[model samples]
Target: MRTLIFATAIRILTPLFLVFSLYILLRGHNHPGGGFIGGLMGSIAFVFHTLAHGTKQTAKSYFSLTFYKYDRKPHHNNLSHALRLLRKNIVRNKKEKPIFIWNYYLLRLRPTYLMAIGLAVAVGSGLVGLVMGKPFMAAYWLKVKIPLVGSVGTPLLFDTGVYLLVLGMVLKMVFTMSKD
Candidate 1:
């Protein structure tokens, strides 16, 4: 049962949750919060969205591609036709819906891919220490300091890997449950 207020609140809160999750993820290495918490926070956004809308609508809106076909005129040289076509396609796609290229590629990924990539990243971070003549899973850091984030290190990469892994895991669960 979808309610107007709930859907509106979800639309407002989803982006905020995602942004806060990133903040948590970024600050995790130096502070209390880390990848696991941040990933949970990030996953909450989609979960809420799924609750507000159905899983199918949420997936279609965020995890699918919007393709537009444009045909060039043989005689017309001006850009007006192309602009018109673009406008027409945009109108046809959906009213007030924003199409972000980043969302299309990133959110469309299957949970398995996310898990594999996250595992690879986590393992690669550990291997970096071995390559540097240190013990496996040893922490390594760059000399240069980055603003806000401070020193960059292997721990950060490992945290990022954890973040992706957790996000994938939770999303997989959510999608599976939604199917039933």
Candidate 2:
């Protein structure tokens, strides 16, 4: 079902798509493109990969490069381990409670947290203006010189948050629906 030509093309274009996504995200604050558009562009690249390769292969490749490792084999769940440890500790000592470890394996691989974070950031940005006795989402800019990009503003942060939120939501939906 996989096409070699399409896979090769996707491999070549993935980096370009990522870079272009960043460009769109950065330019979005002042121009037409921002986080939502940038996120969609990035997601398209992944979708292209998923189409070229199978979903499992694409996810394995992507996760391997990132923090999470996508393992097909069934294994012990983190919550179960935590619960077992908690029970053991409770029986061993009444004074000390079981401490939940936050290791890499215990790390969240879901987009829900990302969505929450994005919502918080967007809300915080709006709240900043409110705290300053201004209307919500009032544009605030800081004039500064950079090597490539010129001036920046609070709108960029809001845009970035929006981008993350959209990206997470899209990825979550795609992965959830595609799962076997």
Please, what is the TM-score per model? 0.74, 0.67
Whose TM-score is greatest here?
A: 1
lDDT (tens digit, per residue) of candidate 1 on 1-180: 589999999999999999999889889988655888999999999999988998887777766666554333474456885576578676775555542223223336666677788889889999999999999989999999989888989999998898889988888899889973
| Ten contiguous residues minimizing lDDT sum, candidate 1 | 98-107
The whole-model C-alpha lDDT of candidate 1 against the native structure comes to 0.83
Report the Cα lDDT for residue 98, model 2. Answer: 42
Q: Which segments of model 1 are wrong by more than 4 Å?
A: 65-107
Model 2 poorest ten-residue lDDT run: 100-109
Q: What stretches of model 2 exceed 4 Å from their correct place?
A: 63-108
Candidate 2 structure quality by residue, lDDT tens digits, 71-171 = 42244467886587677876777676545433334334456766888788878878878888999988787767565556677788788788778877877
